[model samples]
Target: MFPYRPMRGLDEGLYCVDGSFGRSPLGRRMTVLVLPSGRLAVHSAIRMEQADMAALDRLGPVGAIIVPNTLHKADAPWYAGRYPDATVLAPRKAVARLARRMRIDGTLEDDWPAELAAALDRLALGGVRMPEAAFCHRATRTLILTDLVFNLGVQFAGLSRLLLKLDDAYGRFGPTRLFRWVVLRNKAALLASLRELEQWDYDRIVMSHGDIVETGGKQLMRGAFASLGL
Candidate 1:
């Protein structure tokens, strides 16, 4: 299992841990951010061994567990089992899917603790067939997204390349056309949300499935949405 480690040159409070999606071979990432109270909020959890758990403990207590991606819930139950007191938050639509396995403390729309609330804001991508929540850190000027935009630029090889191309995602830096076709129900509403996101002052982007954007994230995001003609 990959261990938790601080992301280089990012804000001191932010960290990332890598894991493979179950049986999928592709690497996935989990975002861990330390709140002002020193507690941690984890997004897209992955199973960790004892040593990694200890490492996380050294960082801070696990205070919040967020299942941001509609389909990325493999480790949520494991995290909830390990940190029973941590608040479990997921998108409204995801609640039903996850309720089959674990208890949900709240949906993204609910009020979070003051410490985290002060630093984070959740944006729900409305009018999409699959519900997803995007988060922003006010202090770091960072945006956290899941499946909205991908930066898997030139990483896959051989069969993976062909499959990604078939998936409409090979080496691309934006949402796959197939994904949009399947989930984007109201382009206007999605466009409005993207435009609102453009208004944010984020310079970095941390996405679950791709390389993080280190700078000019706003422009990158704007260009991405514009590419869809939204």
Candidate 2:
């Protein structure tokens, strides 16, 4: 289990757990946000050992567990078994698939509790064939995204680095060309989602696959998505 690193600031009631994805040496991050009610909201959970779970227990009770997309549920079942009372939420497209692996309490399209809604709001990404949800933390001016934008940069090596570079993925704050080609289905919907993101007034971005964008995030995101020529 990796250690959870807390971000600074009251509004930034977030912590990150870093680990590698599958056989890939590139790091992946899971976000944990402490809600206003003193309960924790965990996103893209990565399985943790008993000692690490004890560490998280020191922060607060787990209230919500989120699997943001279809590909990110590797640890959901573990979390669900650990926190039976916590709400398990996933995108509509992923519920059926995830249900086959573990239990899902609801989809993001359903209504949210006021306490949960007050701290974070979920937006459905309109462009892709596969469903994905983006979250914004109102008080923190932070946007949480999964797979929408990657910043793998130079951390990769050998063939992975070479492949990411060939895909226009390495050393960047935008979506790789290969990602766009394989995952993107509707340019207009994606552009609309980008326009909606501009209105969130986000100053920072927390990405699942890369470095967090700490400043000027709105403009950077707009410019990044614009590379699609949508």
Candidate 3:
């Protein structure tokens, strides 16, 4: 079995899977941010469910659950109504895309405080305008991302296995150069964003469809951007 450690402030803790192909979805460790009051801000919600509500009950309640992005929107809503005061946080653009495919009533973009923006700027993890996106658990040095970069295959199934063979996301780790050129809209700004994010010194990463990088997360991001000629 892979190794896992309970991150004190983060309940339900973090786990990691290691293998030749790197960690797959099944072994990704999500960092759970449990506030003193008992509210929790879980990174990705695959393992979360209605039945698990009782365990989370110890905390006052669940507040502001985040889907992080459209790529990982599938499992978020199952538990939304369970919490009296929680709404899924999704990129404004993704809200429509995901809603069309699922029954989700998520919140639009949130206005972050200037202090938060400045802090990110100081760390070089400045703002990114990727249709609809947000930074999470600033204190954790964590960045929640969607399709801007896919660390794993999309629709990993029978036919998809073959189709993904040539698709940029398959067998590929991190963002492909062509995908970035085609989807980034403006390369100059994206490069600037990467540079800013590099300054933040983040050590962990949470992606919608792949594994969680416990350490060396910043290097993975830096390496991916470097491949794009940034």
Candidate 4:
């Protein structure tokens, strides 16, 4: 396993959860996101240890587990069970497919769903895979994301990490052109997700990777996506 050092991220009112990333059983890692309410969201949840669970409990109990997009299975049941009360919520369209592969049945909720309704502003980033949504919670001006975009660090392994410096994104936060160019399938949907993300009101961006964007984040994200012609 890689050293589990996490981002000691933004101290803003929004409790940004830190998820360590390494290789996944599926060949890519799945980063976990912890919500202020103590909820957990990740790609797959199998065998997530109790120590991590206890650490997250400090932020809040896992009210819900979000499987951001359909591609990853990190938020699986084995992981969800770590929190006795948390239920897994996935996108409406991906529910059945996820259920079949994981043997874990989850309830699909729209956008931030009803539970998160009070806290998030739902903007439709249509055409990108699912009806991608970018959210803004007024309490913290924090925007939560789902593959809608990426910003990797300069410290990761392989030649890809070195090239990341081209974006002027050195070992901290900001967009990773390499990661984006490789992962984004259907540029049309990616573009839509970007356009919608720009309209959101937020100063902090809580990503599933790298460092969190702290200030002028909205502008940073705008420039990040706009460069792709999204």
* Predictions: Cα RMSD each: 2.1, 2.2, 6.8, 4.9
Scored by lDDT, model 1 comes in at: 0.81
Write candidate 3's Cα lDDT for 46-157 as tens digits: 4443334455455445555555555454446665656546645555556677677554444433533233343221211223434535354455666655455657735476
Tens-place lDDT digits, model 2, residues 15-134:
878777766645677888889999999999987777777888888999999999988888888899999999999888778988898989998878466668979988889878777899
Pick the winner on lDDT between candidates 1 and 4. 1
Which of 2 and 4 is ahead in lDDT?
2
lDDT of each: 0.81, 0.81, 0.50, 0.54
| Model 4 segments more than 4 A misplaced | 1-3, 6-13, 17-19, 23-49, 103-113, 122-124, 129-133, 156-190, 227-230
Stretches > 4 Å off in candidate 3: 1-31, 47-50, 58-60, 95-109, 112-139, 153-161, 170-172, 176-178, 227-229
The window of 10 residues in a row where model 1 has the poorest summed lDDT is 1-10
* Candidate 4 Cα deviation (angstroms), residue 139: 1.3
lDDT of 4 by residue, 1-230 (tens): 22243323344434443434464211223334455454544433323355755665565555656565565455466655565566666666667777775544454444354555655565545444443345576567777665544555545555555544564445644444544555556677667766766776788776655555667887777666666684
The C-alpha stretches of model 1 lying farther than 4 A from their native spots are 1-9, 228-230
* TM-score of each model, paired residue for residue: 0.92, 0.92, 0.63, 0.67
| Candidate number achieving the greatest lDDT relative to the actual structure | 2
- Range of the 10 consecutive residues with the lowest summed lDDT in candidate 4: 23-32
- Which of candidates 2 and 4 reaches a greater TM-score? 2
Candidate 2 off by > 4 Å:
1-11, 228-230
Winner on TM-score between 2 and 3 is 2
